[model samples]
Target: MEESLPEALSTERIDGYVDLRSYGAIGDGRTVALIALDGAIDWMPVPSLGSIPVFARLLDGEDGGAIELAPSDPFTVTRRYLPGSNVLETTFTTATGRARITDALVTGVAGRLPWLELARRVDGLEGSVHFRWRVAPGTRFARSSPWVEQTTHGKVIRIDGVTIAVKGSDHGPRGGGPRGLQGSFTTSAESRHLLIVAGTADEPLHLPDAASTDRTIDRTIQNWQLWSSEFSYDGPWADAVQRSALALKLLIYSPTGSIAAAATTSLPESMSGGKNWDYRYAWVRDLAYTVNALIRFGLREETHAAVSWLLTTIKEHGPELHIFYTLDGDTPPEVELLDAPGWRGVGPVAIGNPAKSQLQLGIYGDLFVTMRRYVEAGNLLDAETGRLLASVADRASDAWRQRDSGMWELEELRHYTSSKMGCWMALDSAVALCELGQIPGNSERWKSERDAIRDWIEKHCWSEKRQAWVAWPGAEELDASVLLHAPSGFDRGKRMSTTIDALREELGRGPLLYRYTGAEREEGTFVACAFWMASALACVGRQEEATELLDGLVALGNDVGLYSEMMDADDHSFLGNLPQGLSHLALITAAITIEELSR
Candidate 1:
C-alpha cells in the first residue's frame, strides 16, 4: 500500500499496466499507495485517492516515475506489521548489517493536522547498514516532463506541465553527489535515518504546505489507534483481520468517505495488455462490502459515513445509474491512454474506465442490499434517501431485460443470468422496504416480478449438463458469477450447492478460485470471488469448510497484509492491482459473516 509505494518511482507506471506486487499497502484514507517486496513505490495519487496520478510508475519504468529506497548491500529481507496497527516494518540484513525500516501514512491522530504523508524511517537495529534512495517524479501518468532541481533537502522533482512538486526526504544538503550522498552509518546500538517522500497537488487540493506535509506522525498513529480502540474483534486471526480492516480504511477517500476500487488502477487483471481498467473510482458493490466489514468491526463512523456518501450519490444522480463513479460522484470517467511503455512490456497503459459506459445491471443489487443492511441495523435512512431507493427499484425493473455489458464487461452482450438475478434482488429489497414501511412501493407487484425474474433465470441460465448456472442464457461456460446465488439469496437450496460443487471442481485454482475457465487471458484469482465462495459456503451450512477456505484466502495477503487483484498461482506472487478494494471488501465480508455465524 502507501507504505511501499514511494511518492517517486517508475512503479507508478508499472502499477498502471499490471500491479504492485507482494509487499505492503499504506494509506491515510484520502490517498492509498502500493509498496512492493523489492522496495519499490509503484503508485500514489496525490491530493486524494481518485485524483490523477502524480506517481504512476507501476505502469512504466523510469518514464512513469517512483520513489525507491533499497539496501545498499546484498541483503535478505523479512517484514511484518506493527503489533496493533497496519504500519509495516521491513528488516534487511546485508553484509554491512541489519536495518529495520518502518513505513506509515500520516493520519489525523491527536495533534496532527490533516495531510497525507509516507514515512520510511530507517533504524539500524544490529550492525551497520547502508541504503540508497531516490525521488523520481514523472509526468501526469508520466506523460508530463518535469525538471529535477537540487533543493535544500536532497532533490525536488517537479512536473511543470502538470505543476506537481514531488519532494524528497531529509537526507542532506542539496547537490551532494549523483549517488545522492551515501554514508555508512554505524549502529553498534542505535542509529536512525528517516526519509519522507511526499506528493502534493495544491492546485487540485488547495491545501497549504503546513497542511500538505503536516507533521502529526505521532498524532496520526494515535488517531488510528483511538479509532481502532472500539473494535470488538478478537479471534485466532484477529490481528490479521484488524490489519486488513485498517488497510481498507486507508483506501477510503476521507473527504467523501468513498472507497476507490483499488489503491492502484490500470493494473492489468491479465498480464498481457487489453485487460487494464482504471479502478480509481468507487463501485457501489465494492463500497457496500467495505461498509459491511467496517460495521462488523464496530467502526460505525466509517460505515455510516460511507453509506451516507453512497446514498447521497444515488440521490443526487437520479434515474440513470452508473456502475462506477468518482469519489465526488462524477459521471462515467474520461478514458485516455497515456503515452508510456507498459509494465513488463504489456502495452497501452490506459486511464479512465470504459466500463463506465457499459450498463452493469448488477449495481442495483449492491445498492439495495447495502441500503437494506443499514436499515436492518436500525440506522435511519433519511426521507429523501427512502424515496430515492423506491424510484431506483422502479426504474431497475424496466432495465432488467436489457443486455448489459455484464459483470465481466465483455463486449459481447447476452442475457447474463447473474445480472438478471441482480435485478431480482433489487425488487426483493424493494419488497422488503415496503414491508418495513420505509417507502411506498407495490410490495405484491415487486414480489411477483422478482419471482418471475427468478423463474426466467432458472429456465434459461442453469445448465443441465454442467449442473451449474452458465454465464448467460445460452452459454455453456460455467461462470463463477453464478456462485453468487446463495449469497445474493437467488437460489440456496440444491441448485446452489450443485453450482458451488461444480465451481470448486472446475474453477478452483490451486488454493483459491478463479472467475471462469480458460480465461488465462483473465489470469489471477478473484480475491472477492474467493470470499464469495466462503460466504456461499457459510450460508449453505458448510461452516467448517467455509472457515478453512477463508483462512487460506487471508493468508494470501502479503507479509505486511496487502492483497492484489490476482495471485500468481504458480509462484504465489501477488498479481494484478495491489491493495484492491474488492479483495479487502471480500476479506471484510467473509470475516463478518463468519464471525456472525459463529456467534
Candidate 2:
C-alpha cells in the first residue's frame, strides 16, 4: 500500500469548489446527497426536504460541511451509477493502485426507511490502495455547528434536532471512532470495506447490526433495479429515459407523495444574487410535469399517489392556490437570506422562495393536466375533487384577464402569452374531463371560455413582427416556454413549425436552448427548454432534427444521467438544484414524442 501523496492528491484542497457536473447523486426518497467525483458528499438535506443541510459544501465551500473519502495518493477519478440505480460508483486510479467507491443513501427493510442512511463501500480493484476519509460537518450553512459526541456505534453529530451517527469500515480495524471519524486504511485486491452514516431526529437512532446494514444496501439496489424494470419506454433514448425516470423517483417524498422541484437549496440559477433560490419544495407546475412523466413510464402507483396528494392539498386551499407548497401541503416559511457565501461567492443565499406568493396563473392548468392524466389512467375523481376542478376552471376563466406574474415568476405583471395559454389549457382539459364524465362541470361555460381564450391569444399573443407567438402580447422577445404549446395542443400546424424555427434562430445555443432570448448571455441554457424544443421539433414533423436535438440534450446530463435546473452555456456545468424534476420530465416527454414519431 502506498503511503506517499501523489502531486495532485497532495495539492487538491479538500475545500475547493468542484464543477457541479463532476458530481453524481444518491437519494432514499426523503432526501438526496451530491457526491463529487472525488468521493465527497457535498450537499444533502437530512430528515426531510427543506431541512437544514448537514453537508452543504456545494454552497458554503470551506465553511459548509462535507463527508469525503478518497485515495491518499493522487488519482484520476471516473464515476458512474450502478446500472438502473442511484448507487454511485467512483473509481480512482493512481500510479500504484486502483480502487472503487460506491455511495448510496439506502432505504430500509420496509421499502421506505424511517431514517436517513448513507452506505459507502470500497473495493480494491488492483494492486494496493490507501484511502482516507473524514466526516467534517461544517457549521450548518454558517448558522451553527453540530454538537458531536462519541457513541457506541461510532460518532454522533447533532444539528437542529437531527442525530447522525458515523460508523467506520467494518472490513478493516477501525482507527477513529466518534471523534472526527478520520483515518487512512489500506486495501488489497479482493478486499472490501463498508462505512455507514445513519441519521434520525424524531425517533431514536436505529443502528442495525453490521451484517443487517450491509444487507439493507443490497436490498436497496435490488429495489431500484426492480423499479427500473417496470419502466415501459423502450424508445429512441431508452437509457436516458430510464435514468430520468429514476431521477424523478428520487424527488418523490414517499410519506406524503409530494415530488420536490429539485434536491438542493441556494444553488444559483445564474452566477450571482437574486438568481439564487431554494428549490427543495414542490411546485405545482413541476409536480404536474412529474406526474405526467411518471404516468408515461407506467408508474401508476406513484403518479396516482402524487396526484391524490396534490388534489387534496388544492381542495383544502381552493379558489386561490399558490405556485408551490411544502411536502405536507403547508405554506413555506418566509425567505431567509442565510449569512453564508454562496457558490462561487454568490451572496444572498436564500432559503425559502418568495415565488410562493406570486400569482403564476399557470397553477390552474398545471393541476388540470395532472387531473386529466389521473383520469386517463383509470383513476376516479371523487365528487369533492370534481367540484374543486370546476371551481379551478371557473377561476381560470375569470383570472386569465388579470395581470399576474407569468410562468417565469417575473416581478413585473403582464399579459404573458404563455400564462394565457395555460389558462386556456386549464379550461381545455377541464372540458375534456367533463365531457368524458370523469368530473362534474358546466362543460358549456368551460368550452365557451376556452374558445374565447384561444381567440384572445390568437388576436393579441401573436407577434406579426417576429411572426411567432411571443412571450407577451405585442412583445417581440420570445421565450422557450412557448414550445410547451405543442404538447399542450395550443398549436400543431405550420405556425408552430415557424414558431420553432423562430425560437431556434433567437435563443438556440447549438443543441442547448436558453429559457428566453437573453438567457444564454445572462444565465445558462435551461435543461427543460432544450427538451421542450426537441418535442416541439418532433411535433412539427422534424423527426430527424428533433432526434438530433434530443440526443444532444441527453448528452448534457451528468455522467450518471442526472440534470440540474440549468446548464452553464460556456462550460456546460450544471447550475441550480440537481435532479431537477422539470428537466427530467421534459427529457422523458421528448423521448416519448420521438418514439411516437418513429412509430
Candidate 3:
C-alpha cells in the first residue's frame, strides 16, 4: 500500500429518514462515495478515505454538505449494489416512470492505485422524469469554501485548504460543468444520460465523453465480475458471501493492504448520544481475520497484501505494536473533534483515533493468525517478518502481563480474561512457528508461558456462580471477546459454551450481540458482536442457531448491502461507521464457516 485510502461520506440521520428513496456506495481503494436513491450524494470525501467530506449532508442534512442529482419531483426509489461489487445503482421510479443512477469510485484494475476517483452516471431508464442536481462543496470537515470555476473540460473546485482540484462533469445537465448546474430535463425509456465525474484528484481530471463514459461503465462491470469470479464456494448464502467478500475488499486500503474497521464514523450507534468513535483506521486484530476471509475466497493476492501491510507496520515500529493504524500503516492518527455541529446535534464528531497509544498485546494473536496462514500455504516467512514475530514474542513475554485496553478498547484496564488468552495465543502460535521452522524462538519458554496464561485464565477468569468465564479477574460481567477465545485456541470445552449462553442471555440486545452492556456506554449495538455471535454459535455446534443468526445478520445490510460499525436495536438504523470491515469480515467468516459446518 502506497498512500492513504480516501473516503467520501458518512451516514447521518435526518429529522426523519422516511423520505429517503434509496442509497448506494461506490469506491476506488482510496475513497468511497455514497449515493442516495434520490440521485444525491449525501456524502463524499476527497483524495484519501480519511479526508474530510466535501459533501456530508448524510450526517447533518444540507447544513452538513451534499451533491444532489435527482428528480425535482416526488418519486419512490429502489437500490442495490451491482452483484459482487461495490458499484451501486439506484433507480427512482416517479409518476412518469424510472430514472437509473450508477455510482462507483474508480479504482484501477485489481485496485492497485493510490489516488481515488468516484464516477456517477444517471442514465434514463424508462419514461421522462424531471431531473435536478447540485454539487455543493464543504471545506475542512465541511467548514471551508473551496473555489469552484467552470472549465471547458468540466468544472474544477479548488480547495484553498487543499491544493487539489475537485472536478465535476458536464454529463449531468446541459449547462452543468461544475459551476453548480441546475435545470429541468426529461428522458424517455431509451434515452440514456450521464453524470460522469465528481471528485478531487491530483492530476488533470477528465470527464468521460459519451463514448468514454460508456466504456468506463462497461469496464467497471467487467472489473467486478472478474474480481468476484474467483469465489468457487457455492452454498445457501453464496450470494450474500460474495457480496460480503466484495464489501470487505472495498474496505481494504490497497496501498497498505490494511482493512479499516469501518468506512464512515460517528453515526449514532444508539442514537445521537450512544458513543460514536471514528472507525477509519485498521485494527491489527481485524486484518488478521480479514486475511483469512480473503484467502477463503481464493483471494491470495489480497491476503498477501494485508500480511505485507501488517508486517511493514510492525517492522517499522518494533518496540511496541498499536491496536490500530491508518490504512497506509502510518503512525497512530491524532484524534480531534470537528469545529462544526455534529450529526443531529451529536456533539464532538471525531476525526482520528486516540486509542493508538494504548498497549494491545492481543494484536499479536491476530497477526500470527494471519501469518500462520501464509506458512500453511507453503509461503516462506521473510527474515524480517520472522524476526519481527520472534521479537513480538519476546516483547509479549514482558508486556502481556501489563493491563491495557482489551478488544473493546474500554478505559479501565484490568486483567481481561480474553487479553490473557490472547497472550496464550501469541505463545501458542510462536510454538507452532518453531515446529514449522518458520522462525526460531524460545519455544520451550513460549510453551511454558502459554500454559501459565491459560491456567491463570481458567482459574481466575471463571465465574462458578454465573457458569461462564467472565470479563476479567474479579469482574462479574460477561465479555463478548471471551467468545473469541476458542477460535483463538484459549478454551473450547463446556466452559466456552457456558460463556456463549451466558452472553446471549445477558448481552443479547436482540438477535445481535452487544460488545458489552456499558462498553459503548451510549453507543449503538455493535454489528461485529452479531458476527461474533454467529461464530460462537458455529463453534458450539449450534449449527441451526448459527445459521439463523447469520441469516438475520444479512438483513442488516442497507438496500445496497453496506454495513455501519453498529446498528440501532430499536429502529434497526445503521449506527457507528458505515461499510465496516469487521462487520463484513464477520459476514464472510460466518458464511464460510456455515458452509463448512454444513458440509
Candidate 4:
C-alpha cells in the first residue's frame, strides 16, 4: 500500500504561483520539468535544459505554458517519488473519489531518447473521479508563438522549429486557440489512462503509441531503481542522501556529461527580484563538489564521465578556464532578459548567465581538486590532461596575487580570502598529483607558491578582532566559503574550528547561514553553505555538533527531499532555483564526512 504524505504538504497556490517548496522535478538527462503539487508542469525547457522553455508558467503565470492536470473539483493531495526513482506518484482525493497520477520524463531502452517525452499515467484508485487536463505550450517565453495544426497523426502543436504531439485523451481534442489542447474525462475504479507529450526540434516529431509509452514509463522507473541501487551509501540521513543523489542525477546532462548548477534559470534568490540569475550552466566549483561527492558514494560511471567532460572541454577551450560552461561544454552566451512577469511579480527573468565571463579565481582550485580526487580514487590521468593541469597550476601560482571575483562572482575585484585559499588548494593538489606520478609539473614552484599563499592568507586574511578568517584582507566581513577548506584538508586546527563558531554566530539564522556578511540584506541564506558548515564541523572533530546540525538541515528540504538554492531564514520558504545541484552535493558530502568521522 502506498503511504500518504503528511498533512503539512498543502496544494494551495498564492496569487497564481505555487510556492517553490511545492515543486517536484522529472527529467530525461537532457531536460527537466518542474511539476507543482497542484499537478501543473509550470517550468520545462524543451530539447535541453538550457534551451528556451515551452512551459513557463512558473515565471509568467497563465501566459507561460503549462500542462495542467488534476481533479475538476476540490481535492486534497498526497504524493511521493516512486521508491528509489525520480518517477513521481501524486494521489488526489476529491469529494467524490480518488485518482493517482504517475509522472516521468520517460527514458528509452538504450538510455535517453533522441526526442523529448513526458508521460503521465492516471490510475483510478476508488470510486468515480472527474479529471481535467490541458496541454498548453507557452510562447517559448515570448520568443516563438505556438500554433495547432491537423495532421494525419491528429492535432500537433508547432512552435518555431519544434513540433509537439499529445496522446491518449477522451473527448474532442479541443483547441485553446494558439495556446494548445484540453480535455475532460471521468474514471471508474481500476481504470487506467496514459498521456504522453512528445516533442522534437529541428527534426521530425515522433508520435508515441499509448501502449508503448505506458510500458516505457515502467521501464524508466526500473532504470532509475537500478541506478539508485548501485549507489553505495549507508550513512545517517541515508534516505535524504539517496534522494539528493537522484536529484543530482537529473541535473547531470548525459549528452556531454556536464552537470547543471540547477535545473531552472532565473528562479529568484530573493522575492524582490534583481538577485535572479540563470543557473542552467555548469559551474566548475559546483562540479568539483559534485565529483567529490560522487566519488564518495562509489558511483564511478558518473564521476568518470564528469571528469572526462571537464578535461576535454578545458583542453579544447583553455588554457584559461571560464567559471562555468554550457551543458554542451561551450562558454555560455550573454544574458537576455525576458518580458515575462517573473515568479510572484519578480521581474527580469533571465536566460544566459553573466557570471560566465567573471574572473572567479577559485575555479583553479575546483579543477585541480576534482582531478586529485579522481586520481586518488585509482583512476589514471592521461598525459595530455596531466599537462593541462600542470599549466593551470603555473597560472594559479601568479593569479593568486591578483584581485578578482572570488567564488561568489562579485563584480568588485578584491583579494578574497577564499579565492586565495582556492589558489593555495590548487597548487597543493598539483604538488600531490606530481608526487603520485599523475601529472608532470614544476612541483618545486607549486610547493613554493602553495606556502607563499598560505603565508599571505595567514598574515592578511585572518581577523584577530573577530577571531575568524575575514572575507578578504583587512575586511571585517565573514564568508561561509572559507569553511570549504576544512574539507579540502587546508586546516583542521584551532583557526578553522574557531572560524566555524564565528560564522554561525555572525551569519547563521538557525540551521541556515548567509553566504557572507551583508548577504542577508540582499538575499536568503544559501542552502549549500549550511551543509558546508556541517561538513566543516565534522572535519574539525565536532561530530555531535555536526550531527545535530545535519539533522536540522536535512529536515528543511521539501517533502520529497528536494532543495532549492536558498531558503528564507525567517519564513523557511524556498528561494532561488529548484533541485539545486550544489545543495544536494553538499548534503551528500556532509553526510559521508559525518559517517566517516563517526567510524
Candidate that would win on TM-score? 4
User: Least accurate stretch of 10 residues (summed lDDT) in model 3?
Assistant: 1-10
Native-to-model Cα distance after best TM-score fit, residue 556 in candidate 3, in Å: 2.9
User: How well is each residue in 160-227 modelled by candidate 1, as lDDT tens digits?
Assistant: 43333333233433342432222233333367666665555544321223333335454565667776
* Alpha carbon lDDT of each predicted model: 0.70, 0.81, 0.70, 0.90
Sort the candidates on lDDT, descending order: 4, 2, 3, 1
Model 4 C-alpha lDDT per residue in residues 1-599, reported as the tens digit of each score: 45455455677876668888889999999999999998999988888999888888989885788998899999988889998999999999988899999999999989999999999999998998998889988887788888898898689888988888889844446656755988878878999888788999899988888889889999999999999999889878999999999999999999988999999878888877898888999889889989988898889999999999999999889888998999999988888998888898887799888787788789999999999999999999999988888888899999989998888888899999999999999999999999999899559999999999999999999988888999999999999999999988888888999999999999999999999999999999999999999999999999999999999999899877899999999978899998999899999989999999889
After TM-score superposition, what is the CA distance of residue 445 in candidate 3 from its true location, in Å? 0.7
- Model 3: lDDT equals 0.70
TM-scores, one per candidate: 0.89, 0.95, 0.91, 0.98
Error of 2 at 484 (Å): 0.3
| Best candidate, lDDT | 4
| Error in Å for residue 534 of model 3 | 1.9
Model 2 TM-score on a 0 to 1 scale: 0.95
Candidate 2 vs 3: which has more lDDT: 2
